[model samples]
Target: MSNVFDGYERQYCELSANLTKKCTAATALNGEQKKQKVSEVKAGLDEAEALIRKMDLEARSLQPNIRAVLLAKLREYKSDLNNLKNEVKKIVSGNINPSARDELLESGMADALTASADQKTRLMTSTDRLNKTSDRVKDSRRTMLETEELGVSILHDLHSQRQSLLHAHNTLHGVDDNIGKSKKILTNISRRMNRNKWIISSIVLALVVAIALILYFKLSK
Candidate 1:
């Protein structure tokens, strides 16, 4: 199992190296390099595809699981080849389209391939943007939920505080009423004591007058 994976890895590395070399050649070429590098790239792609097919065939003979995996990989390689071919066609059509300059001039298979490649690129870009927007929306929604929770918590706390304040106010009002009643009672007691003192003073004055009158009458007798 591991050996097959290792083989696939080696093949993948080789294919990557070959593509890189071809691309480098394409870059280095002035005019003739384009044709040569293009041909080389195509040939490399074809060889890689053939290798993938052969590997898939061998893997299929071994086991069902291996077959499935290898077949999937083989399909991927083929898809890559098709994509590269389309890209190459796009490049070719770009050159032809400018010179032909006729809208009715139906482009060849290469042109159609180029259009397909362009459409695929646009689709991929659109998909990426949509995914990004979706992720952002999810994040925003999560933040909003957190904010809503915070708001609910704050409201709960405020409600508790309000209840406590109301309870405290009611308790204070009861205490104030009790204090006012006590003050009124004290005032009434003070008023009663003042009235009793005044009454006692009047009685003493009356007794002194009575004593004086009795003395006068005895003297007279």
Candidate 2:
């Protein structure tokens, strides 16, 4: 930016220097040379004035601080142009027209100010857009974090449910083992009861037979 502005400043300086040289020569020369020098000075002044307006327009695109500095420089260039115009006026008609110069200065300053205002408005609009974009990014990031937390919670719930299912399975397995042991114990008790019943029946039959034999022997005696 500075390079471009510096180029323009250098060009304006060269034009101003050339115009000054022409205005100075117009005073010391004869008929044709003096007229030619005056003509060159007028042409140079027009060119320098156009360049100043161009620089003013260019400054509107610069940073506000930089534009302010450029504007100050532009005003100084305008002053230089005014001085050159006065010199040319003296050379041609030996008169100074302050009114025309004043009107032109006021108009240029007004245009420059308008351009600066427009630049400020554009800068503010751009800043607003950037801030909105930043907010949207923050919202997106927060949503992602919330989603991640929800996913973690769901995984934890699944793990707990899995553990509960495993515990229930283990409890059912223990119950089945206890039922098998109880069935085995009942089968052993039934076998012991059948053996005792047969023993009691055999003992009762033997006693009855022995008592009958004793009665028969006593009758024979």
Candidate 3:
């Protein structure tokens, strides 16, 4: 079964190569020869297209798993066939020389193929930038989350410290009240000591004067 498909592929390749040669030879041809070559290439094209259809049908007869790979190859052949058709079309329409025709076709094909590659490259670049942006956004969000957590912790510690400070302030206020009461007691004691000293000094002076008068009177008598 696979051998049959292989045979078809081989035939198609040979025919395609021959058609390419004919198309090339047609560029140097003129008069009836060019028309004859073009007609022959057209007939070959139709036959090649028929082979492709046959290959398609044969690939379908294959096992489901094998069919996929063969189908893929068939698609490539189909594309190749289309490209050949375009070449013949160019040869027919432009009636230009071979070398110029090749260059023109190559230039056009290059532009088409290059456009696809350029688009892919641009898409990859955009995707890379988007991925980087996503990473940066994730990092920023994580940082913000950590900062928020740290802020909450710091606030909690500050609140605890404030409570401790309030407790200490209350304790110090009680001590200050005790100190004030003690200071007032000391002031009252100091005032009483000063008054007692003045009273004792006056009593001592009065005793001395009374004794001196008694002594003077006794001596005179």
**What TM-score goes with each of the models?**
0.48, 0.43, 0.45
lDDT of 2 by residue, 1-221 (tens): 34456556667776776666566556556578878888888888888888888888888779999999889978988987898787677768734356754554464455445444544554465556567877888999999999999999999999999999999999999999999999999999988888888998889999989989999899989
Q: Tens digit of lDDT per residue, candidate 3, span 52-123?
A: 999999999999998998899889889878987997897788567667867765654564455445446645
Candidate 2: segments with Cα more than 4 A from true spot: 94-221
Please report the candidate that would top lDDT against the real structure: 3
Prediction 2 TM-score vs. true: 0.43
Candidates arranged by lDDT, highest first: 3, 2, 1
Model 1 gets an lDDT of: 0.65
Q: Which residue pairs does candidate 3 place in steric collision?
A: none
The number of clashing residue pairs in each candidate reads 0, 0, 0
Runs off by more than 4 Å, candidate 3: 95-99, 102-221
lDDT of all predictions: 0.65, 0.75, 0.80
Which candidate do you rate higher for TM-score, 2 or 3? Answer: 3
- CA-only RMSD, every prediction: 15.6, 15.2, 19.4
Off by over 4 Å in 1: 1-108, 211-221
What is the per-residue lDDT of model 1 for residues 1-221, given as tens digits with 9 covering 90 to 100? 32454355356545744554454345334466677777787787777677766666677777787668667756766675576566556444445344442331333343445545554664565556567877988999999999999999999999999999999999999999999999999999999999988988888888888889999899999
